[model samples]
Target: GVVGGRSVGVPGTVRMLELAHKQHGKLPWATLFQPAITLAEGGFKISARLNTLVAADPHLKKDPVAAAYFYKADGDARDVGVNLRNPELAAVLRRIAAEGSKALHEGEIAQAIVDKVQKHPTNPGKLSLADLADYQPKKREALCHDYQVATKDFRVCGFPPPSSGAIAIGQILGILKNTDAAAKPLQDGIPSADWLHLYTEAARLAFADRAQYVADPDFVQPPAGSWSSLLAPAYLADRAKLIGAQSMKVAQPGNPGAVKTSYAPMPDQPEYGTSHISIVDAFGNAVAMTTTIEDQFGARQMVTTSAARSGGFLLNNELTDFSFAPADAQGQPIANRVQPGKRPRSSMAPTLVFDKATGELLMSGGSPGGAAIIHYTAKTLYGVLNWGLMPQQAINLPNFGSMNGPTLLEEKRFPPATVEALRARGAEVREMNMTSGLQAITLGNAHGKKLWMGGADPRREGVVMGD
Candidate 1:
């Protein structure tokens, strides 16, 4: 159901990048696109990861264009290190570089997208050309919260809603702050069972709140009249009180002071696939960007500029991010339910950390793991800020989180004793592959000089590079 034209949303990457470049860009727009154009034209060798994904994807072969591009004449995935070229994408990129976002949003490219979505033989979509032409990227205020570790004070900033990332993370950290979690540090460079128990309990509470109140800010009002109310100390203190030595086993959402809402909590659903980038430039500018197409190979529908369809980009199934069941049995609508012109709620947690005392940019970090992104990012932040581990060390630590249900730990990473200890405390512990693609860069002092320390998650394909 997720892998056809019916799932595609109006593409917005070009428009969003253009908006960002209009404000802070120093280089020429065309010059900025030259590298991508070169790569598309000249091609790059396929990696083991790409080969595996292509081999495993069941829906990709259903699309003629995608099948031809990613597979061989015999229907086998291209071997690793095989050069793959996309001249059609190069042509599209060239037009975009020269003509700006208009090339994609107004003319031939936009028409192609509309035609593909509305005319799909099996499952068609309703995306219109007007939707593409009228699309506008938003610039929202970053959600920033004060965090103190030992004597060091810092400000953690994350993307505001239509992303539940920052609020959920803030709630998790805020709830933990009211508990004895900080007093129990890592044991032997790994999180102790004591610490994990508290952390997962906190995560459960945070996710409950997320399901209840977090959504596109334009469509839903924050609880208690302000987003900060969810993270208020008094509210968190009361929430933390629910965390006993034993797991709460599916925690419920807390009332943040006096709040009134008619919306129902969104039921849990599967979420998957995203990419993360953390970059610090020589000019002291930094960015933490998390981009996604909802599922692997997006809608499994490729949009090419030509009838030949030699090369193209995949369309996003972002509409699926909305709640499948729009309302509860009692008829109360869910906050994240799909609506006309509404942006879907996302778990993309692009984050930045600043030194409170000096106002210096301390870190740019984020991850890609669907709903688990909040936990992955929170883990890294806690590791660096609270536990005093390096960014790489934090990323290297085993991924664990509770999305208000079972406690998930990366398979084979935790000790057997740790697993048994969690089970003994009434937690439904499950060991699975928690592949987190996290990238981070933190400010550091090296030999009395300022340096930027960067880390890339070994769980996925990522690298740290600077000149």
Candidate 2:
């Protein structure tokens, strides 16, 4: 399923980095690539994580070029600590460093990408040289909201539409804030049943609205007068009234902004893939960026030079983010349906939080888990801002929430009583692997000096390093 042309979307990470650097970079543009280029050219030990992923992947081995590079002659995945060198990738980065992003978007590298995509053995894609050449980065206003919890004032800002993150998270947290749930403190060192019940119910309601109205703003108009209409305090209060002593099982989208609409709610679709980066420059500017190839070893096809001399780079399968079914059973269109040149809907919530009064950066955090990203981000936000946990403590908290479906608690984390409590409230509970790769850094004091404390999810191999 992963190997094909349909999986690829025009790769955007390069353009994203380019835009970020253009706006906030203080170092010489080419200087930034030195470390990566050095690592690629000099050969680095293959990480245990990379080895395990290579061995676990069913399709990567089938690509001759990929197999030759990642596996031994016996076909076993290269062992951990193997000093693998990618002169080609290093070469690619060197070109980008010298020539800038256009090296990847145009010229020989771009041609190779197009050829590999359209000339695949079986699952060739439609990407062309023009699509790659035509790519342009977008600049939009950051979405920010204020929250007051027990006299603490904070402002949360996140990527706006095209990404359903900030809107959905704002809706869920806002709805919860409007309820008694806001005061349900942690019990026995964990979130109490009452707290989770209210939280998950609020999640269900938020996801229901997410399915209905969130999409690329270029193509789909916000349901209400503006995107903010959905997050209006009054609107959230009205939506919160739907939560009761028992679960609604599934909640339906509310009519916000009181606008007439014709779009059908998109059925829950599989959402996956991404790597999150949270950065703070010396100048105090911070960025939270979540980038992905849509799935692991995206597109299952690797791009390389003609003789496969340059090795390979994974292509993104992001186009799959679109609703496969353009219309619902009633013939009404889904707002997220695929269209030419439209950015697909995403749950990638790269978020930045700041102190309300001073406007000082408070936290930069995000995760990778498709639709569940909303819950992962919300948990971290609530953990750090509400319960006063350290960033790591918050990142370590068990993942739980709904995709407008059955209540899902991370398997083996919640006690049986926790499960029963939700079921007692009529929540259909399911426990399973909820692997979230969360990277976060919080600003606070240690002793007397200011610090930027970092937390990487215990669920993955992420690490925090800074000067």
Candidate 3:
């Protein structure tokens, strides 16, 4: 999901999916309707996290409809079983499924959005009808690369720059693969303390590079090939030789961490609301798509006009993505000023890796979770490809992601032994509540049966089905 203010181009992707359902879908569009229709017909169950976020940030209560759906009769937000109603959204969905996508981009729905955005009260967006009228969803090839480690070749494919996760993972794994460290670092092998130290240092290096060079390709093109080269085996060998057991926190090269976080909002918070789907059509047209409202619930305002009920959600709060503080000229953070119309930086890393030889699809997966999405994917890939674990075992693994902050490790999913081992390594650990909801497909092939697999984030209440 691309969200934030500037990302408020056009938001009828759900309509697009309806028109372009994958050729291999097990259930028809009308069939899928029962699930959501049931929810909207009855009511949405307020999730634990949803309640917590509302309670912590009371400003959310300002949205009467949203608040009414979550809160009790008296006003307290629902705890777990509360039913949230959105007849309007349901009606909108029904319209798109029936009338086709044109109703969204050119009909009354589009007009409502164009109207609302032009008159926004707080941080009003200066979008022109022409901008909305000219918007179109474009497709591009997925970013990918290949590397061989331990005599086994691995192809890494992920959303390119603008998405730091894919590139960052490529850099880190590239370093890890070529390192002289023992192949198996986790399976009760390397002393836990020593291993965690090594992992943290490596993470630090990758993150530094990511922050410095990662940005929307539309704005500043990333030199993925050269950057990947410098971090390749030979370069990693030299860096690995310099890895002493001590922790070292360094600043990003081109952009320094010396830049302070500012109160001013980030520029391109194109928090495109995104959800992913992976399917290997029976006809062999494997499909992997990431769709979103751009940010959490999209631009928070909905319209209820008589012509039709449409997606009321505004653009994402992505404007907060750019540096809000002051900086020098060069667009380089005099404080990361976000320019209008620039695609905001994102962490969405939708990917599809292929079989090295035949070039058939190996794995297709993507997540909607923010920055951590990439880390979650890498861990799962590592488990299945490197450790020989089943897809389920890999998906069920405890999630751990750290980009210089307190390392976020899951609380109770993995074997307690592994958690205890890592905690003792002096790594400041943080336990999070949810996991990345990852939908994936692995093609069955000769080298390995083209297996189609999908793993949902344990933190979410959803399941996957395929042929």
Highest TM-score model number: 1
Find the 10 residues in a row with the least total lDDT in model 3: 256-265
Q: How many clashes show up per model?
A: 0, 1, 50
> Would you give me the overall lDDT of model 1?
0.90
How would you encode candidate 3's per-residue C-alpha lDDT over 377-443 as one tens digit per residue? Answer: 7666766666655556666666776675455666664455655555665456667654577776665
Score candidate 1 by TM-score against the native. 0.98
Query: Local distance difference test, per candidate?
Result: 0.90, 0.87, 0.57
Best by lDDT: 1
Off by over 4 Å in 2: 258-261, 306-310
Question: What residue runs in model 3 are displaced by over 4 Å at the alpha carbon?
Answer: 1-57, 82-85, 98-102, 118-120, 180-182, 188-191, 224-242, 254-274, 306-315, 325-337, 412-434, 443-451
- Ranked candidates, highest lDDT first: 1, 2, 3
TM-score per model over all chains:
0.98, 0.96, 0.77
lDDT by residue (tens digit), candidate 1, 75-163: 99989999999988989999999999999999899999998888877889999889999999999999988887778989899998889
Show the lowest summed lDDT stretch of 10 residues, model 2.
303-312
Better of 1 and 2 by lDDT: 1
Using alpha carbons, what is the TM-score of model 2? Answer: 0.96
